[model samples]
Target: MAGGSFRKSLGYALAGLAYTLRTQPNMRFHFGAALVVVAVALLLGVGVRDLLIILFAIALVVIAEMFNTAVETVVDLYTAKYHPLARVAKDVAAGAVLLAALNSVVVGLLVFYPYLHAFVRFWARSWRGGN
Candidate 1:
């Protein structure tokens, strides 16, 4: 951090992101889901408000994930050996991630249910050989 310029700060942040994506399987999954969400949003032409909510939910999950990664790394740095306090801290961080993931699920449902329902109905009609 000493002598770290603003450009170096950005580089360090990006490096952390790369490390998380490489080391955390869940982070990769979240990124994949994010891509799908963006694709679906574009295809459905969802309203601006709904899209904003979706984006916020996505960011929430990603933020929680990054925080979890940071917490775990710090805990390990504090002690490589097992300790009850370290376990508790890691568990709490993981819980935060789980809660964020669940929240995102609720957001996705609330924002996309109508569009999903319409797609289902369209499929049903097409299945019956009708427009």
Candidate 2:
């Protein structure tokens, strides 16, 4: 890394990201979820602040997942046997992903609840023949 060209470093980073996307199902799922969330937010006309918060939450979850994958890969590389420490390392990494995912869910609910609530109310009124 030291003395490496900036472009070369960027290329390496991009290659790692591509490898992760190609190999990790969880990463793919996160990307798909992110796309859906962003599309919905746009359709709902979410305010800029809330949209930024949503994006941050999405990034946090994806970054945590990537870190978890890295930790698992390193642990597996270091030990093939079932060691207690390896188990602990993997579990801790997984817990990070879970926490990030939970945070994203909370953020999503907070940001989207108002829009969805109004939409549902309008839908109900229409169904009941109310203005």
* Candidate 2 TM-score versus the reference: 0.91
lDDT per model, in order?
Answer: 0.94, 0.94
lDDT of 1 by residue, 39-76 (tens): 99889988899999999999999999999999999999
Looking at model 2, residue 18 earns an lDDT score of 89
Poorly placed runs, candidate 1 (over 4 Å)? 1-4, 126-131
How far residue 73's Cα lies from its native spot in candidate 2, in Å, is 1.1
- Model 2 segments more than 4 A misplaced: 1-4
Worst 10 residues of 2 by lDDT: 1-10
Candidate RMSDs in order: 2.7, 2.2
CA displacement after TM-score superposition, residue 22 of candidate 2 (Å):
0.9
1-131: candidate 2 lDDT, tens digit per residue = 66678878889988878888999999999999999999999998899999999999999998898899899999999999999999999999999999999999999999999999988998999999997
TM-score of the candidate numbered 1? Answer: 0.89
TM-score of each: 0.89, 0.91
Backbone clashes, each candidate: 0, 0
